[model samples]
Target: MDGSKVALVLATSAGGVGRHVRSVADGLRERGAKVVVLGPASADELFGFTESGARFVPVEIADRPHPLGDVRAVARIRRLTRDADVVHAHGLRAGGLAALARLRTAPAPLRLGPAAPPLVVTLHNASIAGGLTGAAYATLERVVARGAAEVLAVSPDLEERMRALGARSVGLALVPAPATPPSPDLAPSHEPESSQDARPSQGTAAPSRAAAVPPEDHAAAKRIRAELGAGDAPLILTVARLADQKGLPTLLDAAAGWARLDPPALVVIAGDGPLEAGLRDRIAEENLPVRLLGHRTDVPALLAAADVAVLPSIWEGQPLIVQEVLRAGRPLVATRVGGVPVMVGDAALLVPPGDAGELERAVRRVLEDRALADRLASAAVERASRLPTEDDAVDQLLSVYDRVMRTVF
Candidate 1:
């Protein structure tokens, strides 16, 4: 109830945690909370939290499990938590570290501080994707449940998964990452040029379907189309990594069949992975008009530049690009996975994951129906308007801090 600032402590190996952490940190700052972020060296550099005018503490809890690195990270976090008003861990490593730091040496014979910060863990995703580290995954979940005062989930699926993983009495919250609207609405600049040249070779190999569109990327599409000599045709994009879980193979086959039709639809995939060489080889063998664009930073610009945004992930925990593309107010054709349906709502055309036929038809439908495109764009614009503003998110976070602080005082 009194006036006091809280500190936000976030950790992540990589990926979306950075996004969530940044949003939280910015929110906290807006609410007058001092934030301290801990993460891998790469994250510290890439995210540039310090440049964003927040304090950043480096914690090298690598994406992969390493016994020594994990132990060291926990110790570093323990030190940081001493002065924290609230310790909220964003991902598994940070959560486990917070949990371990708060572990009782024996049955708690006594209480410690008059105002110990409440420890909260936001379950970002199921670490079942951890493979052989499956046991480690279970252990991490247990530690977070035991150590943290609350568990916050980003989606309903993850919240249910948290319960199944032994998180009892969870404070279920469907806190999807906030989306920012485009700066200066970029309408279609010119009559979209014929995209025939941007089409990839039917026989070209593709990377994983989990590949992502490049950031600030728009020029490459025109370049690819010009190279392929098919710039007049309609171009569709799917942004994700080329991993098996992303359903790249199914999309590729669908593109092959779609190519045999009139008006010639082209699919461009932007991302990188171990599947790159294999995907390219498969494209060559099967002859599909799919192009692979390695990791791009200009994704927002590309979202503005493209005719449509497509997401085809087999399994996902709320992909950020889908939210971003929607915020750009573009029509989207996405597989029904993760929080995509939640983000797109009625704004996007949905297709089943890994269904090439469905994906192909959806893309074709988007191309043929100008009225449908306008409708989706209007709906997307409306949906984007409903997303949590940074100020609102900050206010909610401050409320969480007050709630957490009340327990301590």
Candidate 2:
């Protein structure tokens, strides 16, 4: 395929979706394609698009749907895509905007001649509740599906959901697990330290070279364990957003009874969201053995220090955290929802969603039964090996772009 100019659009600039878009943009750029990113203005500060060598165009798109915002977003996106060969939008809101921009309406005539650039949308979530808000989102989903040149789902379950939601051409592109570097490679390089020491100090405080250097996994893990008061005790780590869909409340309910075990477990939840205050309240009232470390950047270290990783989500579309757990080869206890079972297979102990008792039992078994834990960890390593890499995902995505562009042009 020729080097095409692609516009990668996203509504929000935080979380896994933002990271995925950045990786895709970087990958496309590496392959000689000109990548332009369009998202909320916050994206510039959040992801550092300029540092990554990608041109960023800040668009005013709200996280939630608004009539005026939608109109403005569509207009901005249309102008941005005029010179783009492909427009790839991430999430429902961005997809809807891209779709609206591409639609051949009387009021909004095609500015880029008869054919607009192919719009490829990646649907990240498959679960939505049934209500008026859900109904409105469903309408937008259908519009996005119909307007998009191709729809990509992150998991098999989500692929099916997209098809049912009116997406004609749907493809599955599993989100790759985080690649683990070698132990020696995980160590911080001394080059930055030497440079910092040699450089003359200015009157103003210089930026910390510590932030530039990667932390040693072993040291970081020990530090995290100490902070959590997990002294030789089993560390059950969960890295997820504190959202309703994550079923964090159910996990807390389960944790309340964990003190009954022979040697009580220590739970470290490393994420922040809207439900943080409520979770803190519930933990205080119940006196559960759980620590909420809001939005941690040391997930790899936490995983290394964990005895078991748990994900008690009500719904998921092949969660990246679950994949990270498996990739880290940590024994997993995740709820059997969406594409989680498909992801873990026999490598994780799957419990029913919202079943706090079952979640509790699963965690206890993984902690107590040494042989079972070992078996799961061993299986996890093998399963993770079989999973696709980010490079592979990028190749599959570029293939879709080529296929769509061929048809469109």
Top candidate (lDDT): 2
Query: What's the lDDT for all of these models?
Result: 0.66, 0.78
Our tally of clashes for model 1 stands at 46
List TM-score per model, in order: 0.80, 0.87
The sequence of per-residue lDDT tens digits that candidate 1 reaches over residues 1-409 is: 1324444555543456776777777767765666778777677787778888988877777665688877787677767777776787777767776667654431341243444567777766655365668778777777776666677776667677667766544654434455644433233434433333223322211211111222223344455456545555566677787777677888886787668655566777878876899999988887788878778665665565466778877766666777677676777888887656776789999999988889978877766666777678778778877765556655655666567666542
Clash count per candidate: 46, 0
Best by TM-score: 2
Which stretches of candidate 1 lie above 4 Å from their native place?
Answer: 1-14, 105-116, 128-131, 164-230
Tens digits of per-residue lDDT, candidate 2, 1-409, equal 4478999999884578887787788888888888999999887778778788899998978777788888988888988898888899988889888888886552543333365788899988754567876776787787776778799877687787778877768987657754545554246645423433422232211222121223444455566667787765677888999888899988988887777654567788999889999999988998899999999776777876777889999888768888787777778899988878888899999999999999999988877776777788888888888887788878998899888888752
